[model samples]
Target: MLMHSVSGVLIILVLIATGYWLTVQGWFDEHYSKITSKLVTQIALPCYMINTITTQFTRGHLLKILPDLQFPILSMTLLFGLSYLVQWFFQIDPHHRGLFKSMFANSNTVFVGLPVNMALFGKASIPYVLVYYMANTTFFWTLGVYLIRSDGQTHPGFNLWQIVQKIFSPPLLGFMMGIVLVCLQIKLPPFVESDLHYLGNLTIPLSMFFIGMKLAQMGLRNIRPSKDMAGIFLGRFLLAPILMTILVLPLTVPNLMKAVFIIQSAMPVMTNAPVVAKLYHADSNYAAVMVTATTCFSLIMVPLLMMMVMRLV
Candidate 1:
């Protein structure tokens, strides 16, 4: 199990290294990174969601997984509350307090979490991953976005419509559409399924490439030790996974679900944080540093966490 876990993470790291090397070679720039991100998020990921959900899960499986969503929802809610206490204790910057809270509570479920889970647990882990993704997405769009926006110079009033649109992202829509088809017993034509399978294959590699490009763009110069960075690191790598283990360990769900949920909980900060911060005139650089730092830390954490999960679950 230890060897398997290490090998799985090594595979992901190699892909990430490839992206970093390519970026260093000037094969990819910021514009190419943006295009790659769009391709994965808008096109590849949704197709992956639909294809994985329809093929791997049945109506009964969906029903069973739906209730497990509460674990991630509750864990994140508790983390959000914990963020306030951390801010008060650590005297986190007032200007970016909202960004701090958002990052503290949310994880990059799709980009980092999805590929890591797939590497560790294979295709069987997709449904459990989606369960956590649904909760994480809903929380990030509603409360998380609101918090980040509050850090901006222009504090716009809450916009329900905008929140709805962001929450129903393409990948999420694909998951929902898959659920509908499963419940209705509908199947796509063979050609469409085949096409989706091919496109879906792009998700993991493209996601890794994007991560590498972002890391190359940001570089190590941006990372500096500070109370805020420490707080986020504690929240993401330690508290988050511990909290998830507490929630799911005693449950009767499959051990794979428990392991996947724990791994997802411990993922890096949301990749979207920097974008949202820049949009709202908050500390986008801080957000980027957090993303890069946690992502680097996760490469170390994944193997250890997988070993821990093997023993615990």
Candidate 2:
């Protein structure tokens, strides 16, 4: 298990490093990164969701998974509330407070968490991963985005339509579409399924490339130790995983599900954080730094975490 975890994270790191190397070589830029992000989020992820959900899960499996959503939802809620106290203690700058809180509570469930879980636990872990993804996506889109936006210059009033649209993003819609098909017993034609599989294959590589692009743009030299950075590190690597273990230790769910949830909880900051920060005129550079820091740290944490999880579960 330890070797598997190390190798899994090493593979992801190599891909990210490849992207970093390419970007440094002028093979890709910010514009290319944006395109890659769009390709993954808009095109690849939805197809991947449909392909994975339809093939790996049945209606009964999804039904069983739905009840497990409570674990991640509750864990993130607690993390969000805890962020307030951390903010007060750390005296985080008012402008970056929202970004801090959102990053503190959310994880890169798709980009980092999914791949790590898949690599360590194999395809059987997909459904558990999606369960956590469902909760993480909902939290980030609604409360998380709102928090980041609040840090901006203009505080826009809440629009139900806007929140709804953000929550029902393309990837999520694809997940729902898959569920509907499963419930209805509908199967796609062979060619369509094959095409979806092909498109879905782009998600992991493109996501890694996007991360590398951002890391290259930010430059590791820019990261400095500070109260905010420490708070986020504590939240992502320590508080989140500990909270998840406490929540799942007594649950009757499969041990694999418990392990997946714990791993997902400890993933890096959301890749969307910096993008949203840029859009809202918040501290995007700060968000990017945290994302880079946590991602790099996670390579060290994954093997240790798998060892701990093996004992607990």
Candidate 3:
């Protein structure tokens, strides 16, 4: 059936409405969303990563993917370069350059990527998905931040410790601890393992629901479409994913992994792009508009792209 795309669209629309209702009712505002994002980044996401990876990280398993990590890193780097080139070629406002670069920057690996992949590809793909996230987030905090702030008189600084601190976050720390235990061949007692599973399972749904809540807070009126925004829309939601498909198809990736990869590639610009823009003095409004347009268009574009990738794979 041609329903994978349909299903994805339907699910996102439902989430959009849920977000809209929440915002209209004043249930989710910036303060609330910040708190929720904290929970996701601080606790739930890490717990899920730890629990999921620990159970799967055998020595042999790690060995299998020793080379596959490069695909995601390469994919992300390519996307970043593509974004920069597009911004330069278009002569986009110098102020908007940072956001423009970031628009196609990070993949929505957590919110949209994991659930869809899990549903379609099962639990086996989770570790690979997480590995992809490690690369994306690493680039986002370091290179991403610097690029967005290029206008400052002083040169950009890399706070290695701060970046490391982000990596060693509670959730991330837990994940690392889990990996260590697996490498050391220490098994958790059955009850403790079960508890981990219980807490970890809460992650995906909460993240998705929070994405819905964010949409509500942002409101549809804020999403009023404009032709000025089309370049970003076309570049991110269309061109970037297609570029991914072309680049990846010849790489000898598994069909299913390829499907997951392309869908991740095709996702709307990250919600965090605007956040990065604001923090770095980029054109936050342009970033927001790009985010809005790509996201709304994803209701149409992502599913179709997924379907095409699925067939090719």
Indicate which candidate wins on lDDT: 2
Residue lDDT tens for model 2, 141-179: 668877887888565565888667656767778877888
User: Clash pairs of candidate 1?
Assistant: none
What's the ranking of the predictions by lDDT, best on top? 2, 1, 3
Question: Which ranges of candidate 3 are over 4 A from the true structure?
Answer: 90-100, 115-134, 137-175, 189-218, 226-232, 271-292
lDDT of 1 by residue, 255-286 (tens): 99889989989988987676556545666567
**Comparison by lDDT, 1 against 3, better one:** 1
Question: Candidate 3's error at 311, in angstroms?
Answer: 4.0
Model 2 Cα shift for residue 185 (angstroms):
2.2
Q: In candidate 2, which residue pairs get closer than 3 Å at backbone N, Cα or C atoms, i.e. clash? A: none
TM-score of each: 0.78, 0.85, 0.73
Where in model 2 is the C-alpha error above 4 Å?
114-126, 149-153, 251-253, 275-284
lDDT of 1: 0.80
Worst 10 residues of 3 by lDDT: 149-158
Ranking by TM-score: 2, 1, 3
Cα RMSD to the true fold for all candidates: 3.6, 2.9, 4.4
lDDT of 3: 0.63
Q: What is the C-alpha local distance difference test score of each model?
A: 0.80, 0.82, 0.63
